[model samples]
Every structure is written in C-alpha cells, then in structure tokens.
Target: MSGTDRRYRHGLVLGKFYPPHAGHHHLVRSALARCERLTVLVCAASVESIPLADRVAWMREAHPEAEVVGAVDDHPVDLLDPAVWEAHMAVFRAAVPEAVDAVFTSESYGTELARRFGAAEVGVDPERTTYPVSGTAVRKDPVGSWTFLGPGVRAALTRRVVVLGAESTGTTTLSRALAAHYRTRGGIWSETGWVPEYGRTYSEERLAALRAVDPGADWTQVEFGSEEFPVIARRQDADEERAARDGSPVLFCDTDSFATTIWHERYLGAPSPEVAAVAARTARHLYLLTDHEGVPFEDDGLRDGPHLRPWMTGRFRAELERSGRRFLLVTGSPEERLRTAVAAVDGLLAEGWHFADPLPERR
Candidate 1:
C-alpha cells in the first residue's frame, strides 16, 4: 500500500494547554481517529498562574487514548527569537520515541515543523469545531466564554479575573460583584477577593529607582527639547501604524502618554516643550465619570480627601475640552455606571470596532 493508505503510526499535538477546552478536545479526537498512536506535549513554561501538572492532567482527562507528555525543562527563552525554534525542536526530538509521522497544530509553526522534521503536518482549522475558541480569546472574557470550556476546565477558570481601577471609585464593590456574578453563572471566578488599597502595592523600590535616574541625562534633555518633540510625538503615530496593519478598531483610551505628561507637569512640576507637543498629539474619547445622585462618597484608602472628587472631575473635563477630543460625561449611581459602560461597549461594537490583537474576527 502507498504511504497515504498505510495507517499513520504516530501523531503529535503541542501547546501550552493552560486548561484544555473544547477546541483542544476536537483537535485531539480528530488526531486520534487518523493515527494509530498519539502523543501530546504540553508546554511547561507558561505563566505562573497555572501549574504544568494541572495542564497535563487536563489533556489526559480529555484524551485518554493519547500518551500525554510534559515538555522537558529548559531555561526560559523568548519564543519570538529565531534561535528558540531550533532549541524547541531539539527538545521535541528527544521527547518523542522517534520522529513522528505527523504533527498537529493550530499555529502556522506546524507547517514549518513538518518541513524541518520531514513529517506530514496538519493545521487544524479550530473554527470548524463544535466550540471554536483560542487561549487568548478565552483570557479576554473568561466568564462569558466559559461555554467553550470543558466541565472541569470551566470550574478552574472561575478563580482568575483581574479587575483594575483607580482610587475612591467603586472598584472594590464592583470587583466583588463581578466575581459573584461569574459564580452565579456557574463558572470559575478568580479575583483578588477584595480591593487592596493602591499605595499598598507600590513599593519603595520603584521610588528609589525613579530617584536614582539622572534628571539632566542626555536622553531626558533631548526628550524635553524642541527638535526631539516631534520624534516623541510619533508615539501615537506608532499605535496608528499598528492599527492600520492589523485592521483593528481604534480604542479611545482613558489614559495616554499625554495625560502622563500633564500629570508630570501638575504634580511633579516638570513641564517641558516636549510635554506640550506630546499632549497636543494624543487622540482620545474621554468619558468623565461625574458626581451623581445616590453615589455617596466612601472613605476608601485612596479617596480620603473631600475636595478631590469634584476637583479631579473638573480637571478631567477641562483637559478633554482643551485637548479637542470627543467626550461624554457619565453620571449616576452604581447601576448607572454599569449601564453607561455597557452602552459604550455596545456603541463601539455597533460601530464595528475590531481589536488590533489576533482573535476570532467579529461576526
């Protein structure tokens, strides 16, 4: 019989496999059906959040027929580096009994690996599966995207949402509610559990590093100079370039380098010509949350002063108007905050905003 007619002896699946979800299961099942033997190599050097053994167990439970293997430990290296590919290939060569007949991957690297190993490579189109998903997509909306995960995997993800906000706002209450909502929806809800006050996290080490840097360094002097102003102004231009290349929608950021420049001038008293130029180039869609009825001021550690609320709100609005950007003022109780945020997201979605990052294209 020809090679095509012969039963494939072995197949390999490689990935981080943080928690094997539906897409992963579909790929494994397809591979198992096509090959006499299957091996799964789970990358161990993922983020500190998930353990390697847990990832292996997740894959094993989902594909019991496959021989699941953990990747060999090596000094962490950046995957983007050209040299890393050869190093990774060495590891794979050592782990498998012999060069596998076929390699399975969702990434373009699968094709490259096939060329290198002299084996048939298959790029599985994950979108064709029962629940098409990706790790990055899963990370962006863990609670809402739980349906794509397996029963055991969904339970594990419940404990890992990160909610970030600035002082005196209802971030603490909101964070708790978000976690509770995830649980109520029958998924894992991971957060810090309580809002830890801001300064509690900022350490003296950062302060010392800032102080150690020379105020009159050549780079600093150049940044503050007129000739270098336009060069620094190109920071936003870079973001625009990225957006163009990826066909992603523009996000009107609440904070930008321009705001940082203003804060430096106002709080640090370090105004410069370059700072003005930087501020002038920033594009924004400022959404100033204003004081409203029933939104009582609470004594959170970061928001203790009585005058800061109105003063900061006024300043924020003034900055937006001065900068000549489209803005909207949102004011109301906690319920109103949620409504306003949801409405803004919906508006962006309706406008067909595409994310710059690699993700499933908006339907």
Candidate 2:
C-alpha cells in the first residue's frame, strides 16, 4: 500500500515510554499501518529517565514512516492528584485532540481514557504482541534482558538505580549490598540515591503559601496532613525511570510506597488519598523490607525516633496485599536479609520476567 493510503487518519498511543520496548513497537507499528497517521503522546514524566527526544528517536527508528508527536509536559496536575479525578477528566478533554479516532493502550485505564478523549479504545495484548514486556519488569532485571532493549536504551539503563526506604531501616545498607551483588554478578552498579525528602525541605514554605490562600486555615493540619505527605510521595515517582536506566537486574528498593503508606498512617494518623494513589502507581516487585529489630534505628535527618517495627511492617504487608503487589519481606539479621533478597531475585528470574528494554536482536 502507498504510504499515504496506509497511514492512520488519526490515531494515538499514550504511555510513559520510560524506554519504549518491542511491545510498544508492536502497537505503534500496527497503528501506523492501520491509520493514516499515528501520534504517540510520550508522557512528560518519561523524560526524567529516558529523555523525550530519545524516546521519540527510538519510536522513529522502529517505525520510520509513522507520524509521532510528543506531549510537552506532565499529564495535567489534576491527573497526578488522585482526589481530583473529575478535574483530571476535564484536563484530559482539553489537552487531547478531539479529532483522534482511536487510542491504544495495554492498561485498564485505557477504557476511561478512550471515553474522555472521544475515541475508540484499542487494547494491545502483550502476550500475543511482538514483545511481552513491562517497564516495571525491566527496572527489576535490566542486565538479564539487555538483549531486548535498543542500543541507546540499553546504555541509559546502565547508569542509575534509586533505592528508597523509611528512616533508619537499612536502605543505605541494602542499596550498598545490592550494588555489590550486581557487580559480583558481572554487572555495573550505580546509585543515584533516594528522592530528597521534599517535605522537610519545603514544608514551612508550603504551609506559608497555604495560610496565605486561606488565612483561617488550620495551618498545622495543612502542614502534616496536606503538604508534607504528598510531597514525599510524588517525589518517589519522579525517580522511577532514572532507576530503570541505572541498569541493575533489580532496583532493590529498601522502602517504597508501602513504607510511605505506613508513615502517613502513623505520623498523620490517616493516609492522604494522594499518597495512597502514589503508592498504587509506583508499587512494583523487588520491594525489600529490612527486619525492623535487626536494623538499628537511628535519627538520620530524614528518619527520627524509634522505628515502628511491628506496626509499620504489618502495614507494609497489608498495603502490598491490597495493592496486589508481590514483595519480599526480609527479617532476621543483616546477613539473613541479604540471603533472602538474593533468593527472591533468583525466583523472579526463573519465572521468565523480562524488562522493557528491547533487545537489539528482537528489533
């Protein structure tokens, strides 16, 4: 078929494309071949890890003839703030073109997205598609599946791994151990460190702004309940792609959204809806929990007071279950925790999990 004749008239594919993989290739190729023109809306947050330019470059390389476009910024602010789902709908309606005929996705949210955008929703079946890969899977085990990623992507995945945890919970120790393990396994390990505790840095300033908006507002409530919790939660997601590129089989997060959930519950007395949603979005496997008693609780700048050993651990377990995420809870001494973590990684590898980086051979 002639290029013009075969192109999609108006079709769109929207995703983080942290590093677009063969599965993305399958969908885009199909869309390009079916529609007169295909517009790929690369999420702005995706740029944090794989730059928007690089993601677009990979897409162009894979489907050279397809018409691809980049969305300039993060999904509307309301989209990230889960309490305002309706507001997010309004933003989606305003931001996305009304003329697009179809929207393609492998996520459950695609249906709602199609309705909001006034487009037909096409589901991409990963198992039946050209490549069954997920960004989550790739971040967990990049080295083992380097063959599945593009050249530039493979290079990006090799530079950073972000380890996160609650205060005094052995995050630093585990991150170091994981780095050592990766090197021992003949892989390079790089640590970009944790997302800064934005709450501590900006809490007073944010509270001041809130008070300015509503002079009669309960400043204390807004401080802990409103601003502090959510800021830290949001920062957690900002680091995902960078950690993926740092190219380790597993990102080896010491504490993740689950820990954040416990923090909100314990400190704020109730979990912020925003933090809960962030937990859901960023929750993934390879979440390693250190034994509360074994890791000496110290009052680091971010971590203070005694570690909530029992309560937090239980909360972590519950949140993981509720979120339907698989996690490895490492108890006992430091040595025991390390042994357990290694076993968990091996188990995941044996299950045939592949990361999102598209192998050159597959391309």
Candidate 3:
C-alpha cells in the first residue's frame, strides 16, 4: 500500500519508550503513513529513571501530528501468561480508551496484543534491520548509539563539561585541548563536541557597534547593559545544546551560561539574579577552573587588570563551593593542568550512566 493509503482508520503504537530512540520513531512514522489517524502511547514503569512525561514530550516534539499519550505501567512483561496480559491491558486501556483498528509494533507479542484489542497486527522492523537500536542499548551505553538517537535525547543524555575562569586565563585553550584529546580515541569519540564562548562573540559585536559610530573606538569604549547579560547566558546555553545534539557522548564548553553570571557582576559591579536564572537552565556535569597564578595575563583589549584575576578566581571558587558543584582547580604548568583535567573527566566517565533496573519479568 502507498504511504498515504488509509488502510487503518485508527491506529495505535504502544511501547515502554523508556527513552525514545530512532527505531521507535521509525515505527511510529510507519504507522502514521498507513493510518488516517495515529496514537503513540508511551508506557513507562515506576523503576525507570527517565520520566514518562519527558518521553511523551520527546515523542510529541518528534511527531507533532500524532497524538502522544503517556501512562504509568509498572507491570512486568510475561507474554506466556494470560493473567499478566490482562493486567498490562488494564493499564494500557485506561490511557487509550478509544477504539483501535490497527495495533503496530515490532514485539513478538504483537499478534496476541492485536487479537486482544480486536485490531489487526501491523509488524514493523521486527528484525531490527532498519535502525538496529533499543532502549536497553541506549541506557547501557549512550556513546555507542549516539548516532541513532535524536537531538532531544542527545541533549538530555550528553555529559556537558564546562571550562571557565577569569579573562586571559586559557579557558578557550583548555576547552579545545580537551576536545582534541577525546577525538584521538577515534570511533564515536572522534565526534566529541566543543562549544565556544558566546560572550566573546557578543563582546566583539558590541565593540564593532561602538566602532561603527566611532571608527577609532577601542574595547574600553564598549558599554554593557544589565539586560544584555541574560541574553548572552541564554545564547551560550543554546549553543551548547546544538553541539550536544550532533556530537559524541561527552561535550566540552569553553564557558557556559553559569560563568556569565560572574561576568555580569564584573562588568556591572553587582550581582545579577536574572543572569543566574538563565545559567540554571543547563545541566553542566563538570567544571575545570584554570588558576591565574603563575600564568601570564595577556591584555586582549577585553581583559581586565591582573589584580582582578585573583578576585575573579576567588569568586568562582567560592560560588562553586556554595553551589555544591563538582570542580577541579587547574594549577601548575600547561601539561600538568591538562593531565589533571583529563584525569577528572576520565573519573566522571568511569562512573558510567546509571539507569534504574526495570522490574524483573515473571512467567
């Protein structure tokens, strides 16, 4: 039948969708193509780490035309038992009470499930030849299946590492070096992502705007408004999100929205709660702070005096401590600092992704 053929009046696509992957999406799209109307039901168990609402949201974003619904199904799977089948159906029916003409799935139990629903069984990619991915594989090792995952899922699962410190303290250098180190491992690591400092871009733009009116104007002539800090923070966070979607499992950031709050204070001579709120939007996994000590401060026209370095470093340390964020102080030679940074990141990756085990199946 053609893709636009409405073979099924009302179709149903149901799955645990613990975390929506490309395979699940392909199944849903196939069902949509065959049916006039489609409903993608996402069932998540109580023990699952990823929230049901989040899965629903991801599905909605992925397939906006389809009606996406979520339900809490804590029942264990046992295709052999009729009693277990009934129990599972009770939860499923509660979420989707409307009549279903076709039930689409890749599971072996699709025949019985469609029989019970009085609907035709529409099998799709049962052998996993098309996408060749599953939620279990993603939960176990996201890096291995990074290419199979969509942008929203990648943004959520990506381990974000931010490198930040006072101006002229090698923040950009360390971030790029870290990304380069990861890329050497090859495979998925070769695609390791790095997000640049959006604040610098904003600074350059501001200086250019100043120079537009006065061609000889220097960086000192550039002025900042309290309202602009939040804009910069939001843009930095957005840039990180874009990189995480297409990059490897781990992503490196030169400076994040969180660091923008400190810069806001430095420029405006006071704290900015608005900028802090913007910073809170990102999930930064680790932070590497480059110590200004023993490092020559280059006046890049945008940098402040050397005396401000100690104060800025102290502020970052104190804020990180108060906020209870995990951070490493990069002191000593450049080589030693890279070693320390690599070790810290390695320790974090060593922990691996933790997914709560689902309820054991029973016969």
Candidate 4:
C-alpha cells in the first residue's frame, strides 16, 4: 500500500539496536511518517555489550515523535526453536501497551514478528539500498563507519586522543597535525578541525580582562589558584564534548582535565577535588606525551619559566604512571611526533576498538 493511502493508527518497530546507527534512524523515521502513533521497542539482551538503558535512551532521543520503550530479554537468542516464539511473544505483549496495527522492519524475521503481533508487515530498505549500514558493521569499526552515525551516537563513540606535556613542548602543534591527518583520512566529523586547549584561551582572555580593568595590576605574575583550575578543567571538558557532539571520530584534545589536575599540583602544591573529578570523568583513550628534550623553551608570557620545563614533564609522567593511563612518549620533529602518534592510534584500531564500546580502563 502507498504511504499516503495506508496510515496505521499504531505501528511497532522492534530491534536490538546494539548501537543504533543511520540505518536504524532511517527505519524509525520512515515508520513514524506512516503511522499516527508509533511505538519503538528497543529490545536488549543481558549478553549485549552496550547497556540496555543506554540503547533505549538513544532511540528515545533519536525519535521523539514515537513512544520508545526498553524491552529486556535475558533468554538467549534461539530463533530456530518454535518454543521460543511463545516466550518472545509474551515479552512483546508485556512491553507494548496497545494493539499494534502495523510492524516496521528491515529484517526477514519481520514476517514472523508481524504474524505473532497480528499486524501488517511494512518493510523499509529490506535490501539496504537506502541506508546501507548495520549495527554489526558499526561495532566492528566505528571510525570506518563514521558516515552512518547520528550526532548523539557519534559523540558517544568519538575516541578522545590527548596530546599533552609541559609548555612549549609542541602540544598545540602536534594536536593540530593529528587532527589534520584524521580529517584527510575521513576520521574527524566536526568542522572545527580539533578540540584545542580551552585552558590556554581561557587564561589569555581572563588575563586580558584583568589587565583592561586594572592597567597597573601585575598580570605577568598571575597566581594559579584552586578557583581558576576547576573553571579551566570544566571548560576544557566542555570543549572536548562539543567537538565529539559535532561528529569527531577521533577527537584530538590538546590537554584534558587530567593534565589540569597535574598542573593544579604544580601551581598550588596540592590537589583540587573539582579538577580531579573532571579529570576522572573526561578520561581519554590515548595520550601522546610531548617530551621536553631538545625543544627550546620560548617565552610565551604564559609559561612559568624555562627551568620548570623538566619538573613539569616529570610531574606529568608521574601522574600518568600513577593513574595507569595508556600513553606513548612522543618527541623529535613535528613530522616524527605526528607519525608516532598516528601509528599508536592505528594499533588501537587494529585491536577492534570501537568508540561505541565501553570506555577502556586506565591502561
């Protein structure tokens, strides 16, 4: 039946949606167009890698036009046995509130599902012609399947790569290089190039504001206090999250909140709980530590001093080791550093690491 002629009062679309991608979005959107009220059942099993609640929330947010519900099926996927159908039918009946007039699906199993529901089966992109992507393909290589993800899903899957070290250690330079490289390879989904160091920009702008208000104030000796570190940490995290939401497959962060915590220890001679909390929350997948060796320290006005370079680098190393975060020490020319960092990320990809997977532990 034509879409305009056949409108269902109630439609049902059911799927595991391991990590909902563009195809699922297309299916749900198409279904919503034909039904006055649609119900999307996000079926999740215990053995699934992605959390059930998370999948339901994703579908709910993605399709606000429809009523989305989470359905948990602890039993194994035993499609061949007819006995399992009765149990499956019971689960569906309990999850869905009302009678479904139509069922929307892209799989062959839709025939049986519709039969059980006693509803008309409506197929969408059965051959995968319209949106040629699947959850299985996404789970294998999320970065490779960047085009098939929505902003919310993409943000969740964006792998944060932080380039950090003492001042004048080429952190900004390397961060940009890595971002450019990823963009060329179709990794970055955002137009902003990369997630730059928000702390640096924040400090500079604040210093300028202070100098403007009080011209006689010694802005050169601006003391680092607990008050500012927390602000910087939060800003840095927000910047990174914005990049992810904009569709960065591999987000290159100049410095993360973890680096902010280390800096807090350096400047205040103690730990800031706020900074530490932000650091723990915004942890990155990989870190490229820019070594201070052979790099001449230039006075950027913001830097503490040339003598503090070694101490800063040492502190960063100690913190990284203590936290047991995965890191690769990068040094030498800009080209060499970029090459090394890229290789390390490639190794991570080779391990079947997908951004949609659970965040890796500190290692």
Candidate 5:
C-alpha cells in the first residue's frame, strides 16, 4: 500500500511525554500517517512534576486528530518482570481498551509492547538522530533544548520578565536592551523576544482616529473609559503569550497586563477589578519597577503623567507588595538600570526549573 494509505486499522502511541518535545510529536505524526485511527496515551507517574492532565492536553493540542488520554502509572518500570509488565499493561489497557493493530514508538520496548497487544511493531526513529531530544534532556536543561519544544511547552516554561514603572522611566529601553543582550548568545538565543506595551499602540491608534475626525484634536482631547482597561489588559496578556511562545528561554515584556491595572487607576482615579481579573490570567516571573527620580520625564505628546510619577511609582510598589508579586525596584541612570536588570534576570535564570523525578527506570 502507498504511504498515504492507512496500513493499520488502529494504532497506539504511549509515553510519559514529561513536557512533550518535537521528537514526541514526530513519533505521533509518523504513527498517524500509517494508522486509520490513532490513540496517544500520556502515561504520567505520581512523581512527575508536570500534571498528567497538562501532558494529555499538550499531546491533544499537538495531535488534534488522535484520541489523547492520560493514565497515572506509578508502578515502577521493570520490563523484565512479568508481574510488573502485567501491571503496566493493565493500566494501559484500561486507558486504551480497544485492541491495537500496531504500536508505534521510537523506544526500544516497542517490540515487547506490540507483542503484548498482539500488534505489529513500528519504530519511527529508534536512534536519537531524527530529533536528538528526550524528556530527561528537556527537564535537565530546558534553555538548551528550547527550539525542540513546541509553543505550548515553550509558553509554559519561559521566564517572563516585565519592565514596568512610571512613564519615561526607561521601561522600553531596558526591555529592548535585555532582549538584544540575550540575542548576542546566538543560536536559539537569537530568537529572544520582547513584547511592546499594547496600551501605547492603543493610545496612538485612538489619537490618530480622533485627529482624522477633527484635524486639531490632540493628546489632551483623548479620553480613556473604565471599560477600556480590561480590553488593553487582555490584549497585552495575549501579546505576551504570543511572544513567549515564539521567543527563547527568556521573554522581556515592556509593561504587562498587571501594569494595565495601575494605569487604569492613573486615568480613572480608582482601582479596576475587571482589569485586575484579566491580569491574573498569566504568570510573570520578575518585575523591574524603574524609579522616576533621576530621569527627566519628556512630554512625548502621549504622556502627561510626569507630575504623577512619584504617586504612580509609590502606587506600583504598594500594589506589587500588597499582591505579593516578586519585584525589584531599580534606580539611577539608564546604564545602571540595565546592569541591575540584567543581574536580576540572570539571578532568576540561575535558579533553574524544578521537574520532580519520575518513577525509577524509564523506557
């Protein structure tokens, strides 16, 4: 039969997928090409840090056509022991009860797995050459294997750094500098991303639309509605997510959704529960609050908050502390701020991600 034609009536692909990488996706894709119907079993153990449901979701998202399911298989791996093998098979069978026509895998145990199911063994890439990556390698050094990871996994694992503070406090400058510095590393680091403040774009667009209607209209004539904060916050959050998914290990965002809540207060003179709710949707690792003391606020036509700088800075500090968000207050010249920000970001990265040890003896 031709490769495009389904050779198997049913097929199974199983793994811990402890944070699915490209290699896992390759195997699933290869299996789908050969089977009329396929099931991806994400068998996670109790000791794994990543939740079983998350693994199942990632696999499902990556291979939407396949039936993706999860099973907690805490039982230790002992392929040589018939009793242990039977225990695993029971879990596997319970999760995927239908008889398998073929078992597709890049693992050496595919032969035994297929034999137990009375199915044929189809090995996609027994060697690591096709995609030289594994769950162990990912867990050990995610930054090193960043490109091998898919967007969902990358978004989940990326270290998000937010540069937010009073206007004219060098948030944009520092954020751009951080992204550029990381790009100097070359390789995957060249993809280091920086998310622009969506609020600025919104403001520019609003002003332009207003000027189009009345040629004399300016920033003073611009108005912000309380309802608009949530929209900007959501858009900012989405932009950050997009950048994180495509960027390197670290993502630099100049003013994030959380900052939108503060700007809401600046414009509307009160807190906004709507914007705060939207801001809570995503996680940001570190906040660099730039102090407005030494820097002169330039009236860039879009900003009239120079007089409110101290209050804004104080308010940002209070909110960050009140909400128990991790942050660092930065001061001095642009050079000093960049140096301090880099040190803080490097420190955050030094504390590597912690992935709980999976059940002993992996396939």
Candidate 6:
C-alpha cells in the first residue's frame, strides 16, 4: 500500500537521541498525527556515555501521548552492513513486545527497516525540510544550535556563569537573584535560573548523616582531606549538570569546582591533582568575582572565619588571573552586585556567545 493511503495502527520510531533535539520532536509529532498510537524506542549502544534510562525518561516527559521504551543494544548502528542490520533488527524486534504496523524515521534506512519488520515505511522529513539539524552537529556546537534543543538536552550543553568569591560575599544571594531575573520575561535570556552550590549541600548532607549516627557529633570538628575535594568537585559538577538538564539557557552557578579547589587548599593545605584537573578541564563562560568589601559575614557551620574572607577572595582572583580566564570584579551593595552581574550576562548575549570546545593547550 502507498504510504499516504495506508493507515498505521501502531507506529514505531527508534533512534539514539544522544541528546534529543527539536528534529526528533518533529519526527515524533508527525508520527503521532498520522498513527493511532506511536511507540518510540530509545535504543542506545552499550558504549554511549549518556544513560539510556534518562533519554527514555525525557522522551516520556516530552511526549506523554506516546509509549516510550529504553533498551541497551550492542549491535552496530550502521544499517548498510547486512550482518549488522540483521543483528540490530533482532534487538529491535525484541524491544517491542507487540507487532508494529509501520516504521517511522527520517533516515533512508526506514524502507529496509520497515521491510524487515514486515511493516509499511513512513518517512518523515527525510530531506530535512522541517528540522535541519543532526545529533552530531548538536554535540559539536550545542550553544550555536541552542534553539534546536529541548530543556533537558539544552542543560547538557549550557554555558555556565559562575558567581564565585569568599563566603558571605553575596554569592548565594546574587545567584538566586540572577535566577529569578532570568526566569522573568524581557531579558536577553528569560525563563532560566541558576544552580545552587552542591558543595555546601553535600557537606551539610554528610554532616547530617554523621549527626544521625552520632547525636553528639560536632559539626565544627569535621575534618577533610585531598580525597574529599575531588568527591565534592565531582558532585558539584553532577549537581550543575543535573540542574542544567532542565534549567535555563544560562545557568548561574553559585560556586564551582574552581572555588572548591581554593577551599581545598585553605583547609587541607593542598588540592588533589584530580580535583584540580577536573576544574581546569571544564570551562565556564564567565566568572563574576564578588568582593568582600562592605558585605556582612554570617557564620554558617561550613564557612571559615570572616577574617580569612579576604585571603580566600584574593586566592580566587589569583587563580582566575593565572588561568587567564574571563572574569568580572563585582563589589558594592547587593543591588550593585546584581546589576553588574546582569550587565555582564547582557554583554555576553549581545556578543552571541556560544559555548565551543576548549582549544588545544599551548606548549
């Protein structure tokens, strides 16, 4: 039967969706409109880094109307190889519990896939007329192709604006304000917010666990080592990434691993090479340095004494300068710091800043 004339009872579409984008959305939407029901199989290779379950979750969240399934298949993605295609087809069949009446896809292999499944082929936007972006292109330049991504995938490629400085320098306050501002309309980037500091949260959680086990445990006496910083650094990265997966276009970080590294040195006398390496590898779009001048220092159980704030702040500045990273020094009242941060973000927007791959290190 002809593609247009035949009605599909149950349609199937499968793809990696390495990071799902608008193009995938378009294909799914088109399939849903034509078929009575659609089953999207998010088949990921065993070798891919992104979690298959996470991708499946996004698909379900994105298209609640369709039935989404996640599966791990070690078969080759290349459909041109007969042996490989046969192996993949077997996995595809097993992934779907019931019979599929039609196969929906944008790739040229949809005809062969449908034939193998004993179903009709429904090609949607194979010529890329509707959505002209690919997963590979999105990976290479996510910031450039930001418009094509959904919130979850957008977070995967988000540019970070880290609000870093000494304790009580309005880092948390500024980060929350920045998030609120972005969530409101009429700005360069709206409906976006910031990621809270994971380091402090993790510490608080660990301390609470200790307290739970030992009621008389003193929070002030908590000790740390080089290993702790690396763990904190990794968790900090995880928190930022998880928040960004569904957060705004510009993710304002209350603090980053870079700050964690400084704290490591202050407390442990030396930062672990692992933590330092992680901080150096991940690049941020901009660093807004909050000066301690005229800011009140309130003691949180985790913070060092107010007297050491300036020294810590200086070390942060030194780290930024030594790394030759972009930074903006923000001082004055809370309102002033927010204004400066906003202006910096606005400037970035004006310049059409898109996150690109880090350049090769110089000799």
Per-residue lDDT value at 138 in model 4: 85
Model 5 vs truth, CA RMSD? 2.1
lDDT of 3 at 101: 97
lDDT of 2 by residue, 1-363 (tens): 854344446888887676676677777777776777777776545326456777777677667776656654543433334445565454444555558888777876778677767888877784644575766656666554465676557535433233344456675676667656755655343332233334444555665677798876543444355556666766655554455544444454444544566777877788778777776764355566554766777753333456456666677667667766666666777777677777776676566543333222110
**Relative to the unseen true structure, what is the C-alpha lDDT of residue 342 in candidate 2, on a scale of 0 to 100?**
70
Regions of model 6 farther than 4 Å from truth: 1-20, 28-122, 125-148, 186-190, 209-219, 353-363
Model 2 scores what on Cα lDDT? 0.60
Which wins on TM-score, candidate 5 or candidate 6? 5
lDDT of 1 by residue, 1-363 (tens): 665345578888887765567778787887887789999988755333567787788788778899998874453454455566678777777777576888877775677777767889876774556666777666565545556676455434322222222335554454444334333433222221222322222323334444569533331221222333234335533442332222212122223344344434433455556666665553433333334234566653323344545655565567667767554565567677656654553454344312223212211
* Pairs with backbone N, CA or C atoms under 3 Å apart (clashes), candidate 5: none
lDDT of 1: 0.53
lDDT: the better of candidates 2 and 5? 5
lDDT of 6 by residue, 1-363 (tens): 765767789999888887788899999988898889999999876666677887898888899999999888875456567887788777887889788898999987788889988888888888787878987777666555677888676665566899988988889899889888877854335647677888788778878888998888766767776787888888888777777766656888999988888988888887567888878767788899999989888887777678998898899999999989899999988898898889998887556533233212121
Decreasing TM-score order of the candidates: 5, 3, 4, 6, 2, 1
For model 2 the local lDDT of residue 70 reads 60
- How do the candidates rank by lDDT, highest first? 5, 3, 4, 6, 2, 1
Model 4 misplacement above 4 A? 1-4, 186-193, 354-363
Worst 10-residue lDDT window, candidate 5 = 1-10
Q: Output the lDDT of residue 28, model 4.
A: 93
Better of 5 and 6 by lDDT: 5
**Candidate 5 C-alpha lDDT tens digits along 174-270:** 9999999999989998999999999999999999999999999999999999989999999999999999888898999999989999999999999
- C-alpha RMSD for every candidate: 15.0, 14.5, 2.2, 4.6, 2.1, 8.3
| Local distance difference test scores for all models | 0.53, 0.60, 0.89, 0.82, 0.92, 0.81
Among all candidates shown, the one with the greatest lDDT = 5
